[model samples]
Target: MPISGFPEWLPPQRMIEQFVLDKIRSTFELYGFAPLETRAVEPVETLLSKGETSKEIYLLRRLQEESATSDDQLGLHFDLTVPFARFVVENNGKLQFPFRRYQIQKVWRGERPQEGRYREFLQADIDVVNRDTLPFHFDTEMPLVIGDVFRSLPIPQAIIQVNNRKVCEGFYRGLGLPDTAQVLRTVDKLDKIGPDKVAAALVETAGATDAQAAACLKLAEISASDGSFVDRVRALGVTDPLLDEGLSELLQVVETAAEHAPGLVVAELKIARGLDYYTGTVYETQLRGYERFGSVCSGGRYETLASVGNTRFPGVGISIGVSRLLGILFGQNALTVSRSVPTCVVVAVPSEDKRSGCDRIATALRRRGIPTEVAPTAAKFGKQIQFADRRGIPYVWFPGSPDTVKDIRSGEQVEASAADWTPPAADLQPVVSAG
Candidate 1:
């Protein structure tokens, strides 16, 4: 069989993915975020408003041959954000102020897939949508919260660079750039294509003058830092009211987040993300050493992104690309699965009558939260112990023996009551750790 970048691991890899998800989910819930899920598809019109993302969408038709003529259709979701917006708008009345939700699910993109990029992949997203106004502080807090989650895991140190679309747009317009949107598209690729190509595109494509192009290049250059970066942008003399307004709002978010999570937020100006829907704050997270993974997680705040009966639904969020993060970590040997699959303490039965004793001990251990399995058949003590070692099960319970347990690795046997015996937490099962 053949496989693409949609990399799959054995039991070990699957266990690592679960570990990453648990850490992300715990962090979101710690901040009072609830959980939510949306259907895989929405009406085409609902999706079209998402701008460039729609181009990456995978369409589902009644029949592949009749797709052109059929109005009956659906498209696999490319991201969780858009469908979540629709959900908030449809159910806005029932939601309370600052409704926080975390969604972990699969989103599909039919675009050409590559390493760390898949036709189908899982995304774990945490979002905050307001019944009315979503305070800008969350724009700063979102990344810190996400960074905190990533930091909690055994994964490497990851950084989240944040920007506001309003600031980028307003700054471009103030500089006499005609097509700010097109200018942004070029700037967004600065990391991939580099500064020179971006500068040429700004001048040739967006009609930016030599001075404007230089100033634009400066605007696009921001590094990983705290809110101090905001002062650098403010020092520029040539600016307009729109630019000033965007800067002010952007400043508030950084200050607000720093007050809570000290040294967490940065007022990066270069994050001209390609998404047109992001009205205010935008963000991208890169693993410290693995910047080539592109962004392990990225998202932003979109104002009035979803409209239910003309009522604008505003929200802010960030998503953890579970599959990509796992793939990279797996490749680097940063992930470790300590326990074998399923079987923990295999209760050995030396005789046919002893099998019943083994079964009783297994049940007793399982009730105490130790995942225990009985030996497949009656066997010699040494053979039974060998089976446990092969499965990475640390302890073997020989029920007929006066001493019921042996640490297979250490070869230490001890006598204990079945109901009272407990394996060290780490030995209970194979633990998948970035540590």
Candidate 2:
């Protein structure tokens, strides 16, 4: 019916959505973060290295004749992190350590589309990596930056749930479950497949007995504040070294983050990312009352996920589902821009004979960084004003008037200077309608 997985929008919607993404990228860049993008496809083998993540990849194929060799070497990227690791390795020598970069691009997943989960969607990601070790503080602060973007948009309160991979691994190993990675992938699907299916899969593939599966479920079910969750993980009688270390690290991060943005990060012990790649922290985000919309932001820490020669890169980061978030905002009427583009003032063209005069006035305003557009048609003055009104451009400029501009919104034409004309702050730029 509607291109099932790929979604597009009309002018106003696309405009508002782009406004959100622009702010995200801009905020990241403001922090001196560079931007980078990788090819959409990576070697199939690399994509499959993470079990359930591989399941989501939309594979690529040869278009030529059957004579083509079976390279079995390509697939669409499901996320930005893996390809980024490869990118750093491929250009290690030329790159700077503690590389800070942001990427805004499309990712593909061959999954059913319902609400926020689209088969193909755009993501805005930011990460900071180092040659060998990335500071743990990034785990706490990076989410705050992400939260800032959401706050700037002034949407509903968003909560960030964080957990540790080592904690999950240790807990699973304590339960006598072999292949903790496999178990993780299954548990990660708990919200989607429900406990019964996840338990069945775990028992079937993980040598987990019914009771063991229940125990794993109990672990998955155990999520709380830093102190409480750590206590629950300890009570499981799973004596593992990684368990204690992960617990301590998670506590430090949660405490550190709380110091900056109180009550923002939760120690959600169930956030087992299931990918062998994530070595430390993991994150999930949701709107306060719209948790069912799925995670609007997600990512984590990876240790040694990228290696080249004798060097490896370890880092932490997160991504916002820009398109998904905007779509949700639109559906709920939570955000919207009045027009697709900002037009500070539109110069009315009385007649084609007066076209050059209109161009001069529009140019004068535009040169000063004011977004100005000239009336395209030679029509009645009322018609010209309507054009600006329909586009939601606030003020209309008249070339021959002695510095007079009309507030299309208020219908008050005033004597204002083309050089110093200022619209009220709120009316200067169109706001995103909340719906």
Candidate 3:
């Protein structure tokens, strides 16, 4: 029986995943981001620092150990950002200022099993961190990179919905609501619980007046694909320096994206990320036609998530939920690959005594960068060809007088050299594409 949330892909589907990951990795590197990886486990207290994700963390424990000790207090990280923060704090002196890096790793969460939700999944993240003062331009740059990534993929179009914490917090503070975090959290649930429940939560939990709740909802409803959102926000009659600062910052992000990656991003005021650490710009990505699956990617800017002494490492980043995105696509039969296995050529074994000769041919092909395997048994020629056919192997090389290779599908055999014969580039590897 397979575990519900821990997904395992078949060979074809795994090929699709590798295909997507390659595009993401190549695109990240093309933009000069170095690759990085961190340990899977972090101190329990460290994971708990994010506050909202404590319940979703999976703690690590040894079954053989009788009791726990202080050193054993650890848990699997639920997200990459928290671990990245600790990594920065520990390695601050060794790294350069304004470091850029990309990480693709499996992250564990204890959320209930559902479509597009998982207990274990892969996440790809790119981030730029600065020691003291990170540039605001990096915020805009995050979405542009993400836009390039999605555009390169075979999946449906991805629209990155962006918002800023300062916008939400400043607006709430302007309404005489000091507990901005509470109000932001409630508004973050607007998409899940709807506007009515969110309004009630704002008044009941955030201790906002009914009128203040209405204003908060109004602000949440404001969205635009361009700078027009700025004027709409101004019309709300909320005046505060922080609100003005946030509005200007968000406008820059929106306008920059419009100029570069047109139609790839939108200013969505309701996108208050649930994580409390996001102090500035926040992001959420929705796949067109898959809206019910929720945001397949999300992250934000955090000014104080990592620090050592007086040094603060501020960063802006986004993470793609690789598993969730693929899950949704796979459920819809939206992706496929040319073949299940990587093997491109199979050398037929004429007889048990001739297996050694076939092995040599296989070796020669492999040395030339062609994926090849010798027949498993000294079976009949028909049976040998059948074996290759069953595995989706395209070519069958026969080691004999004037060695010939057959394109099994076309039923065409041609004389060829094991040392130099090459299949078409498309047949060299499994070709992944939209179904």
TM-score top scorer: 3
Q: Per-residue alpha-carbon lDDT of model 1 for 246-344, expressed as tens digits?
A: 777777766665676655556667886676788877878788789887888889888878776656768898888898888777777888888657677
The model with the greatest lDDT is: 3
TM-scores, one per candidate: 0.93, 0.91, 0.96
lDDT of 3: 0.91
Q: What is the lDDT of residue 221 in candidate 3?
A: 93
Order of candidate numbers by TM-score, starting with the best: 3, 1, 2
Higher-ranked by TM-score: 1 or 3: 3
Candidate 2 per-residue lDDT over residues 337-383, each given as its tens digit: 76655887888887899899888877777777788888889899899
Task: Name the regions of candidate 3 deviating beyond 4 angstroms.
Answer: 69-72
lDDT per model, in order? 0.78, 0.81, 0.91
lDDT of 2 at 361: 76
Supply the global lDDT for candidate 2.
Answer: 0.81
- Alpha-carbon error at 358 in model 2, in Å? 0.9
Clashing residue pairs in candidate 2 (N, C-alpha, C atoms within 3 angstroms): 333-434, 333-435, 334-434, 334-435, 335-434, 336-432, 336-433
C-alpha RMSD in Å of predicted model 3 compared with the true structure: 1.5
